[model samples]
Target: MSISASPKSRLLITHVLDFNSIFLFKAQVSRQSLGVLRDMKAAIYPITRPTIGRKKIPFRPYNTFPSGLKAEVVTFDE
Candidate 1:
């Protein structure tokens, strides 16, 4: 499952959170997709924090998506 941001871009949902009637989902996307989401004012956040030994690595949300890859969405049953 995917949401089309444009004729050439798409967001693949990887995780889903359901709260009563509202749904929150996660996606691994490209910088282009990130920009699109930002333009749409979607709530964009880093999915994880990286740490090396005692130092916390800086988080860059755009790095989450691997290069040359697309994503898929997940559906759940109530």
Candidate 2:
């Protein structure tokens, strides 16, 4: 099977055969492939969940100024 030029980071056939969670291992995959063990569990390798930081980053104002006086622009990377 062949994959197109799409850059999705989901699992592909190659990843499923041998799973590795270490970022370095996953890096070897092409853009279209995903972490082999992402969906399944195995005895040799434990499935790990992404650790969510329960404590939020302390919010500090980057720059405080009069709202009206500042020229503002916003962009969403999403």
Best by lDDT: 1
Off by over 4 Å in 1: 1-27, 41-78
What is the lDDT for 77 in model 1?
A: 13
User: Residue 59 error for model 1, in Å?
Assistant: 30
Candidate 2 scores a C-alpha RMSD against the true structure in Å of 16.7
On residues 1-78, what C-alpha lDDT tens digit does candidate 2 reach at each position? 355332322221223444421111111233223343353434245433432211111112534422311222111111
TM-score of each: 0.17, 0.18
Candidate 2 wrongly placed segments (more than 4 Å): 1-34, 37-44, 55-78
Q: Per-residue alpha-carbon lDDT of model 1 for 1-78, expressed as tens digits?
A: 455432222233232452212222333344554565567554364432211111112223446533313222223111
TM-score of 1: 0.17
Sum up the clashes in candidate 2: 1
| Clash count list over all predictions | 0, 1
